[model samples]
Target: MRSLSLSNLLRHHKHTAFGHDDSHLPRQVIEVAIDDSEDTHELPARKRRGRAQSTAGTIKGVIRRASLSLKGMVHVHRRPSVTAEPSDLNQQLPNGRPTSAHHTWNRLRHAAPFRRSRSVYGLNGTEDGLYEQQQLDHQMPIPAMGDEPPYIPMNTGAAAKASVALQNEYYNRQAMHTQWLQSASEDSNDRESGIGIVVTEPFMESGVSDDGSMLGQDSNISRIDFIKELPSELAIHVLAYLDAAALAKASVVSRHWNEVVRNQHIWRESCLREMTTTYATSEPVQPGAGLGIPEIAPSKNWRQIYRAKAELAQKWKEGKACPMYLNGHTDSIYCLQFDEYKIVSGSRDKTIRIWDMQTLECRLVIGPPEVVNAPNVLEDAEGNPTHYVNLSDSYKAAPSKPQVASFAEHHKASILCLQYDDEIMVTGSSDSTCIVYDVRNGYRPIRRLTHHTAAVLDLAFDDKHIVTCSKDISICVWDRATGALLRQLRGHTGPVNAVQMRGNTIVSCSGDFRVKLWNIDTGRNIREFVGHTKGLACSQFSEDGRYVASAGNDKVIRIWDANTGECVREMRAHDNLVRSLHIDSVSGRLISGSYDTDIKVWDMETGRQLLYFPRWHASWVLSAKSDYRRIVSTGQDPKILIMDFGADVENIEMLKSANTGIGGIRL
Candidate 1:
């Protein structure tokens, strides 16, 4: 009965294990009694029924265990486990409980079945054991209701194949990344090497790159643009290193760069800067005038009459070509002439000044008298001195403070031209009259030839004739000996402005835009050159008499063949009117002066502009003449400028001193 009761109790507990409620009290008591009794054996009939039922339950549990084991085996076959050392899987229990041999043996037993199944299915035994051990470890904590199933291992074919494939993919990716890195490193190394070679080469010989070029090369290396991009102040400092000739060339590079290099203050600073160095060692100790003949006169000693001229020349060189300052004239200078002993200047100040040519000092200023005398019988209202008159009261006179030359007051208007022959001087006035003065005698006019209805613009004289052109469209040939009118050649329809003589032929230019060639003997117009588009200013025949150069307001300087009267060459010579033209007979060079204040030298044969003096004058260069090695230019600045083009420096220095004034020296 106890055995039967034991079997009944076990069966009841089995059903109750899965139920939520417990209703069998007898079954519980029977279970307690069987547990307390020793040797509690069952009877045949009850034992048989109990054994059948227990067998059925055990079989059902075994089938369930097999199914779970099969599932674990399949799972393990798909994915292999990684083996870890005992140290790697270490786990601390609560209260730091130490692992015992008994615990290890039990754990091994729990994983034994999985290990066996793994071996049969061609799976890794060690990996299967690890996986199964982990499963048993989790299940061990739960109380066993009937029987707990053991872990089973799986096959390893799928997991091993998957791992090999993954390893191959990883190796391929790594190889590709390494190749990319290597290529990039090579490219960087190549670039660095190229740059090093380029930087080490000399600028002139190197073919690597140029900053000035506009091609694919880097702009930082371009020579010209790099220079241009420099800061203006820095650029000015660089330009300061250049000499005058170099600076002048730099000014033509570009407009912005030109402004930086051509600044007047910069030029002045450079002049002063250079002077500081030169003055310390090379200051002129002796007067330059005493070194040679005075520039004004080849035959005179400038030292006696003009010691100041030597001092001024030294000062001019030290000052580095600064313009000379003159203070006598109140208006623009219109005419300048140098004689053997004096430098005469005429101005709109209504005065003519004679400066000591040797001394470069103003010696005399002659104008109309302060007072003039009326003719007898000319009376005032008071009639006090009707028969007598004060001659000084009839004209203007110069101041008495400075010693001045005696001059006749005759012209009622500005004097345009002056011609001197020894003691006789002839002056053409804007008043349409020519006055002949006996300069050796008292201030007296020998004759007044009134032939033109308009101003006499120019006058020329030879040994026999005095030829004059007037605004009245007439050319008057006169006897220079007696101031008598010889003949009048009248063909121009406009103002006849300039006259030139070539042997017996008198060539005249006019506002009629024509050049007329006339026979002085017959007073007949022989031929006319009629290609000028503007009024002619001046004309001159070449020294060989083969060509005639004519300049005018048209800004064109035309050279015409003398016999054919056909234009041989035309030069756009000036920005404004060509005021004067002079040819160097010995050098075959042509020098032109213009209202643009510029003087240009040209090679007549090639028609090429040789040199340009852009700012030689502050106003119109009204006249220019060159005598082989020296050029003299006069402008509205009331000063004559002398330029020497000779090999003898001593002679030039002497000439500079002799021709002294508030003007320029040629040397």
Candidate 2:
């Protein structure tokens, strides 16, 4: 029970009564305690009287490590019974043989990780017939790959037949140990230190000393920590291959290994190389790249950072999240977008609602000014005046609905699409028009662009131009500052469903089964991407505007090269039409919502479906967006579902710049 170091234990083990000459031999004695109730009748002669002539005179139950005698079979020497003949010993009844020895050797044999094959130890042979008897002393078959040295010994001897008893004795002792384990398996630890043996099972497994022996005290061989002896830089390089789990195990090997595991070099490799998302602490910064902001914490702990990333990645991989519902929308939500502070959604109910991120309350609502602010329902409210009890409280009437609503300045039809930045907010409607408002100026109306003759299905804008696609088979571009119609891009035979603008490039997908690229300034059709067999519903430009991704009624997402019009990647997973697709380049992930009522996440680069969320909406999913911490989606079920995957991470704001596109998960 004492806390002793390996050095003190080895010192005591070395000073055991063996003389200098005997101690120089290869094998040393290990003391094994014999169970009191052990049956000695089955064994040849089970008692040791006096080793006065030998070195074991002071110890009572000391047994030498099993060795091969002169015969080809193992010849174990036990108590010297003067009455028993060598030949008669073989005929002795096999009843009550010590199974403890068999259990130990069998355990060590199967457990040695194959340092020595069963053939070398005659383990494959029975007590009746020694099939692969050891003829040479200590010599074994060559070590196999991934196995280490200090090969376990096998039977040896041609002169001695009954002496094959050493292996049997070893087998006998191990058998009893196996019996003890079985009977005491119900113990809390499943360990039988009830005998007070100093060598516990874990100690025997992990406590090997310098020479790879049970106790290297008596052996003349010297061993050193070659890993520690390596140059410090090389040591870090070697430790890099051991992942987080292996590194944890290696840390306790010694103080040297612990320090190496704690070194910044080790964790820096994990954060920069192993992690998919870039850590703010290690990422390189470029001018005007504000996202490359440093961590808010004064000092960084690389190890803690890696641990956090690993845990969060696992949560995403497992599709683990907590859900919060926004239940205001009365009809199918056609389009929505959000930043870190609030969520804005437009629905078929002819209203646009703004929800606060923290309070989850609708802060503002925009609807038609001429119509009464009342929900259109088939329910007979007059007949329901005498309503009875409902199925549950959840089916009861609404208790707290928004009291005030703002009338839309221009939209007379359903608000279908919207986008916003710091300066202005833009909303497109089935009225075939787009209304721009000062986002920071109390939602003040800026101007209206009514160039399209049909429903404005989708819209995208940058600093220079507002791009809108329509059901009238037209794509219109307007100056953001002047409200001037810049270009009327028309090429598709069918109505364009989605449009995205980035710098000089504009990408659009139409119901005519074509995805096209355009030069915003000249209104020239740069290229057309041809892949989908059915109408396309959505399209977007990559961060660099070099690649385009589109999805639609075909239920597949295709990525294309803008310059060559070549289909570069196709992601196929959804069973029904994929209605929406959003590419987050920072995280390198594609967020998808399907008409099958599912929202799925994909690795854009690998085209692998990392995972999908469980069904939370009863109707078609219309839109979905994801960041590092959360994924927000809406459906025809008229519910807004916000699932927060990284809700537990405290400093999650650090991940705002880079995306988790390559984040690894267990799936």
Candidate 3:
């Protein structure tokens, strides 16, 4: 009987295999036989007419068990056949069929739950309501395992309300999930697009924690403080973009930034950069054969090369004022004079220094004598006081000394003024005397005029006339040939400080604040140009004799039309008082020296300052004079400076030769 049952099972399994290949048939058949044996005794019996029900039930049970076993085996073995070569599974579906893998997955997901609850809910008949009911079901709590519950249809009453609520919640959850996915996609898109927008989103989201309060509060504070603490260098970088006026104001905001902007090099570089950019496109540089080609044939002397370089440098600095450095004095220079041959400077150092005009080098320095009476003290054989007699006789018999004496130690006071004619030089001093010296000889004093009660401040000369002004408010006119006082002009209420002679008109400036024009022959004031507001320090007539320029303690230099007495032009000449004035006849250039230690030249025609020679003295620039080609300035620095407006080439060459190779001497 068992054999029959097994054979029957084999037959049923074979029939269920359908079109499966027989290569795996033995394994399937063995599995089915084992399954049938395990359940053989427990199977229900089959019933037959008039047979005992127990036996019949047993038979039926055995048949049913065998049948189920055969079915399970067939299902396992009935896989579609695979050929040795891969199958061409690229077959087309029927027209109008959903074709993609994605479509298939979606359709399967929707159909799974619908198929499960179709009968219990009658969902198959109501297609539209089926989706709504499914949505409701998703919201309900899940049932425990193995509990098969009936589908509950959504309705229009309380169940409808519950259903609507459930539908809303389900949709809301779906929308939230969808939104989250969309945001994540957008964030990824932003990152990939390099927009930089979404990069900070994580930080923004994290800024507020789960409790909705800011995280890392102290860190945020610190970050804010850090931003506020940006360095001044950064501030300056920002300010650099501002306009010049605005930038200038910003420099005052802080000391550090002020220092940066004040640097001249920065401004210079900025100017260069701006100029380069501004002209770069419009201006094309002319091509050069080489850096510098000699227009003249090259010479063997390197001096030629140096000379060319210096010439180029001078041309570059043309129209610009240059500094003149002078050194060759031992005491304050009291007088300065220059001619074609040499520059002569007299100093209280009791020396007269002579500088070669062409070479601009000191040629000689004449110092004071050790003794003034050595020649006269010589003995005549007997050793008696040979020339000694009465005081008047001794004075007359004494050998004459050098008139142009350097009474450096002998004089108790400073020399105030110096004047020279062809053969004689007369020096006025604070010692109340005018000493006349024969300059052609060894500086022997020809005579001494001692009538002045106070220091002699100024001296002037004509062919046979000698005029001197003194602090005694007096002017003494002396006969130059006889060394005798010719006349005295004494109307000035204060010290007569300066004297000038133009033909017969003797012009004098005084501390009395007036320029008194006098007729030298009559020794009487013809007219007084009296508009000056301060003590007159200097006065000079124009070369044309039409105007007189006077300057004083008021710091203004006024030019008066000498004939009309009309103020022509008033120049605010210096920061300090004007100490001296000299007009160059050839150039019509007015030179003024000031207590500010500056020598300024002005064009008389335009009344414009032409050149400013600054710091010409460490103290007051006491005097300045110009002869068109050169300017000579004397100051309290005890030095005389000779400035050449011509032949700077030679000067530059000399300077270069002195500075270079070998002995390291500078001319």
Candidate 2, TM-score vs. the true structure?
Answer: 0.58
lDDT (Cα, tens digit) per residue for candidate 1, span 1-667: 3334334433443453235233443453434434433221222567645645674666443433333333333322222113434442234334343333334334434432321111111222221122222222223221111122222223466533433433343344344333212222221122311211111112212121112222222335744554478987777777777656566655644456667875544554454343223111123222223222322323444223233333434533332222222334545666665543455566655556555433444545555553123221123456532212111325322221223333454666676776665466677878898877665553246888888898898887788988998988888999988878989988999888788777788877888789888899999888788788999888876655667788899999988877998988999999998878876543467889999999888877777787677867779888776542345567787556655343223333333333222222121
Measured by lDDT, the strongest candidate is 2
Off by over 4 Å in 1: 1-327, 339-341, 371-402, 405-409, 439-444, 644-648, 653-667
TM-score of each: 0.45, 0.58, 0.44
- lDDT by candidate, in order shown: 0.54, 0.61, 0.55
Model with the higher lDDT, candidate 2 or 3: 2
Ranking by lDDT: 2, 3, 1
- Report the lDDT of model 3 for residue 289: 11
- The per-prediction CA RMSD against the true structure, in angstroms, equals 32.4, 14.6, 32.5
